[model samples]
Each structure stands twice: as C-alpha cells, then as structure tokens.
Target: MSDSEETYKSIAVLGIGTVAAPLIEAGLLANNASVLVITRPSPKARQIPEGAHHAAIDYTDVSALTAAFRKHSVEVVVSTVNHEALDVQPAVAEAAKKAGVKLFVPSEYGLPSAGHTEGVLLVKSRFVDSLVAAGLPYARLYVGGFIEWIPYLFAINETGKFNIIGEGKAPATFTAISDIAGFLAYVLTHLPPSQLHNVSFRIQGERKTPRELAALYGDKAPLVEISEFPPSVKDGAFRKFLQVAFNAGFASTGYDAAEGKDDEKRAGSSNSLWPGHQWKTVKEVLNL
Candidate 1:
C-alpha cells in the first residue's frame, strides 16, 4: 500500500481509564485521525474528552457495538477495558470483525503475557486466542510496569520506609503512562496494516533494579529487605508474587533469563518505531 493508503483514519478506543485517557488525547492531537471513545452504559456521568466522539453501549450486544463502529466508520478497535472486564472482549472482537474493522488492540499494557498459565495473565492470553479464532488482526503492546505505580509497587508509603523484596538487584522495565499512550496513538495512525497486525511491540522507557529505584528517593527513605510482605501491605500474596516474578527476571517487557531456551522468544524493544520521541525515565517522573 502507498504511504497515503497505509494509515487508519478512524479509531474507536474502548474504556477511558488510566491508559485510554491519554490515548484519546494523542489521537486527537494526530490531526488526521478521528478518535471515538466507547464506554459501557452508566448512570454516573463520564467526562468525555473534548473533540472526541463518545458512545455508550452494551458490550454483550454485538449488534449495538457493530452499529457504533459503522456509525463512526471505525477502522480500528482499541480495547483498554480493565482486566476485570476483559471477558467482554470476545464479544467486542466479534463486533469488530462484523463491522470489517481493520485492527484490534487488546488491553495488555503490563508485563509479557504470552506464556502465563493462571490469573489475569491467563485471561489476557485467552482473549488474544479468541481474537485469533475470530480472525481479527491485533497489535499487542508489552510495556512492563507503569512508572507512576512504582511507588506503590515498592511499598513506599507516606512515611520514609522503602520495602525491598529480596536483594533488589533484578532488572525490571518501566514506562511512563503518557509514553505508552503516545506510542499507541502514533503507531496506529502512522504504521501500515502490515506492521500493526499480529505484532507485539515491546517498549521500555527505563530499565532499573529495585535498589536503583529506591536510591532515587534519597536517604530520607530507608530500605528494608524482606523475603515476605509485612501485614501492613495490602494484597500481600499478589505483591509477593510480583516480587518473586521480578527476582526471577519475568518483569521485563520481553523474554527474560528465567525462561529457558524452549520458551518463545519475544521481539526486541521497538522504541525506535517512533523516531525522535524522548521517553520519560523514572528520575524524571519522580522529579529527582
């Protein structure tokens, strides 16, 4: 396809949560693309982003979803639905296929999920499988952990304690929320279908160990290493699992050392895809 024909002009973004908000902003800033934000019907008012179209429909109702896509002339469907509501995606994918949408971007803005067997990751992996079953092309973005959440993940509270899991030497990837949103919008409106479809774009704003991150807080925060989470920490089990995953090298965007040679090798970091954009780092995010 010619450069003029490669880009998708109309896009419908599902859910306007943490990641979706900036995506809508970026799409609107693209100038050439029309952004449509889709949400589930609710009595509570939603602050629809200015200059973007809004639609509230029953996700289970394929007909309603299909109609919305057609009404907007939506060429791509980007699902930012949170993990708890991910089950609705198969229905959304069906609607996208029926509407002849060109692409579907699944909500996988966290760690690498291709080989997960249990929990939310499993549900995410299965959703991708459903997309394949429906014959819908997709682009999966693996961006490790969000930079803003690092404080919570590290158990840094209002007090001056920094809880470190294990040795805190394992390398982990982190990306700013704005960077993720900007990258998604940039690629969807710029890359050709050939590059967007069925691709896993692994990106990272910075790679740092837990110790390195803790030091950024300066001497005011004292580091305390422990094998298990203290009772003070909420969601102890899940938090413990995350620490273990990090220590085992599973927290990065792509393949890690813990996964043996037999495991699938993920594509390398694709940050270069968006040329000249300076990714935000942890120090910059923390104002250090």
Candidate 2:
C-alpha cells in the first residue's frame, strides 16, 4: 500500500502490561479501529480487554510476526512492552517493515536518552538508531515519567515523603497513564502519517516539583532530603546525578542543547497539540 493510502483502522499492540493496558483500552475505544493484543502462545492465558481481540504467536520470530500482521491487516504496530522486554522491539519493528506497516510507536515513556543513566537508556537509544538505520517510519513519545507511579517512586506509602532530586522547583513533566493512553488513541485515529511519522511527541499532564506535590497532598506527603535517603533508595548514586541533571536543564522538552547552553530556561509542551483533549493534573490524579 502507498504511504498515503495507509490508514489505522486495524492495529496490533504487543504486550498489555502497565503502559500497554491503557493503550489497549484507548485503542479499543477508537470506534473505527480494531485493536488486537498480541500475546505469546498459550498455557498462559491473559484476560483480554473487552471490545478488543487477542492473538497468540511467537513474537520474537519475525516471520511469524509478519504473518500475523498480514493476517490482521495491521496497518500500525505499537510496542508498549516493559523495559526488560525492550530488546525484542527492534525485531518487532523489522517485522512491521516487512509486513508493510505504516507507523511504529516504540516503547519510550520516560526521560529522553540525554537524561537517562546508562543501561536501559542506552538500549533504547540504540533501538532508535536501529529504526533510523532500517528506514522505518516511527514515532517516539517522550513523557518524562508516569504520575501514577510517582508516589511509589518516592516511597510515599512507608515514609510519607519523597526526596527532592534537584532544586525541588523545576517543573518536570509528568503524565497520567490514562492521559497518555487517551492521547495515543487520538493520535492513532486522527493523525495522518505526515503528522505522525518521525517525531518526538512530548506530553505532560502537569509539571510540578516534590514540594508543590506535597502541598497538594498536604501533610500526607512531605519532601525529604536526598542526604537522608536510605542506601537502598540510591539508584547507583542517581539522586545526585538527577539533581544535577534536572537543574542543568534536562527536565523537559523544547531543550536545544546548543541554544544558550542553558537547561533551566528550556521548556516546551505538546499538550497544546490536541487542544480539544483535557489532561489530568497531579491533584486530580491523587484525588486531592
């Protein structure tokens, strides 16, 4: 099919874990799109979401994956697999290309590679390189972090507090999982390939610091000092690194590393891209 002829009426998504769950829901909600979740062969049955279809296949096998895509007439493929399964994404992309899929959304929903430490981030960056090298048309969504997991990231349940990684004032991006999924649905059905391909769509529900977040939650959540954080909480001494990184302007999009060479003054948001869609703020998410 020609690029212009490609329309996302039927799409296949790999995995239905945390991030994938909402994406599946959103996709199914698109009245015109038939959303299918691709799972590994049975003996392990997963509860398929209502209004969606499920298929079992050896996703790692490119030939099988391509066949599955062709069978489903999957015009678009979205990979929302977890970080550990990220290595399999390139193969998925390769299969999509072979199957003549028009668009691919890689599994990126966190910090931009520039802000990540080594390991997983490196693998993700390499995946992007593979996409470019293989000539695959893809969209990489960079959402700073999931707001739903923020409370746990800071261990709010046990300590009722979280550390201020940086100055505790920078407006770091955070998107509710539901909002991310909803936005993904909007993009898939509404955006044409010309608007969807080869882009870093940065979005955020709201940007707030630990201190500001504490205010919303009141005394229930307080800001703790990184110095007092337990040893187990240390992400390879990441606290210090993130503190420096966030202040150095690694917090949000619209960052031109060359322009002014200032990270603090940099800011941008794609929330305005879909003006009709309403986003959830941290306050609404926490029910505060």
Candidate 3:
C-alpha cells in the first residue's frame, strides 16, 4: 500500500459487521466507487458486492486503521461501526483526516439530531460536533423515527401494547432502512465539502395516528390513550447545573407551548438531494 499506488477510487468502511452490509451494497450499486470493507482481523465473512476490497485488521490500533485507509486508497470513510467499535470518534476522524479521506459519514442513521426538542438527543449532539472538528466533509442523514421497527426496539409487541407521546396524534416521520442506505450512499458519492449535510426523510408511509396503528394490532393493543408529556423545564439561574438532578428540575411551562407552534411542519426525507429522482413510498414498499 504505497502512496503512489492509490488511484483515489476507494471508499473505506470502518465497520462492516453491523449496518455496513446494506451501505456497501448501495455504494457498490453506485458503480463509480470502489469499496474497502474493514473488520477486526477482517473475516472471510459474508457476501458483499464483487470487486470490493476486504480487510480484517485491528481497528483498536490507530496505525492499523490508518494503514488500511492507505492500502485501499480510500477517499471516503463511512463510519458504520457500532459506537463501541470506535469508542472515540475523534480518533477515527483524526485518522480519516490524516488519511486525507475527502468525506466521512458517521454512524448517525437514527432520528435527526437537530429535530429533537426534549434533549433526548443530547448525546448525539456531542458526536456530531466531534465529526465537524475533524475537518472533513460529513453528511448526517436523519430518518425520522423508524416506522416499522420501533415495536421490536421498545419491546412493545411483547406486551401487546406501545407507549407514545401525547394523544398519539403527533405526525412523527419514519424512514425505511433500505431507503436510508440508498440516500446515504447517494450523498456520500456526492460529497460537497467540510460542512455537515443535514436532511430528514420519512418513508412515503401514510402518517397513521397511534390509535390507527394500535388498531392494526387488534386485541393485542389495549384501548389505551397515550399522552405526550411536554418537554419539562427547570427555572434556575444555572439552568444547566440544576438540570443534572431531575427532582430539582421544574419545566418552564411556557417553553413547550412556544415550541408547539411548529408541531405540524413535519419534514419527511426530501429526495431533493437527487432532484428529478423519485422515492418509494411505504405503500409501494408494502405492495399495498
């Protein structure tokens, strides 16, 4: 893996074990990018698109990760590894920065970080900051809540019931997994610059009310009424310090009311990234 050998066509994925499978498939589908899949002691592993490079190495070792980047001549680094896989994003970003990778996509395929109001996303905000400081072009794609999978995630199905915020009437957005990979690969191949691309998308699924969703589950779903607890606030000269303790916390009653004005302006995944390109709605996905 000499400096002279890199032709600049490779896209190195730091963790291929978790969600990289679909991303790699999508990247390879793009036809212009070469894939370099990296794993721990890189396994003989599962199937990926043909012509992609595979490496099983010690990612814990910064030098090992760097060497793989150089070996593949990767211009883009997709960080699909689990948070534990790369405990320190700054480290990976530093490696990507040094490797001169033109673009980096961190593992942020969940709900959009910016859209959250309850500070449910406080942890994610920190990671995005780290990516920005790394000094490479990054795209953070937000798929509003997962429409079909949250049941499994929250173990709602086990109880034959689910919990949601307020009257269950809020029209929150949700995105399909396949669509996420497609959108991400499309954006990565079309990297713009050092800025983080922020866009939220939802599947073309009908925005069914919670009752409607629960009804679909039949007797399994209780005739339950779910209510959203408004974002609580604390009144303090030191808002940050007092918030550390929930008992000391008192929500600013007016805050949630003020924020409520924009409740209806839901932003689904916009295919504007690829103008003239159409997206598949949930109906099409379910063959309805």
- Best by TM-score, which number? 1
Model 2 CA lDDT for position 204: 70
Q: What TM-score fits each model?
A: 0.91, 0.85, 0.69
Worst 10 residues of 2 by lDDT: 259-268
User: Model 2, residue 231: displacement in angstroms?
Assistant: 5.3
Clashing pairs in 3: 41-56, 42-56, 165-228, 166-227, 166-228, 201-269, 202-269, 233-250, 233-251, 233-252
Q: For candidate 1, lDDT tens digit of each residue in 1-288?
A: 786467888999999899998888765445568888899999989988888899999888899999999999999999998877988988889999999998999999987777677778778888888888778889999888888988778777633577777887877788999999999988988888889989889888888888888888877677888777778778777777777777766677765333621222342268999899999999898776
lDDT for residue 47 in candidate 1, whole number 0-100:
83
Over 89-182, each residue of candidate 2 has an lDDT whose tens digit, in order, gives 9788989999988888888877665334366666877787788788887887777667887676565765667655546665566788888887
> Total backbone clashes of model 3?
10
User: Model 1: residues >4 Å from true position, as ranges?
Assistant: 3-5, 256-268
- Score residue 37 of candidate 2 by CA lDDT: 86
Clashing pairs in 1: none
Query: Which structure is stronger by TM-score: 1 or 3?
Result: 1
Ranking by TM-score: 1, 2, 3
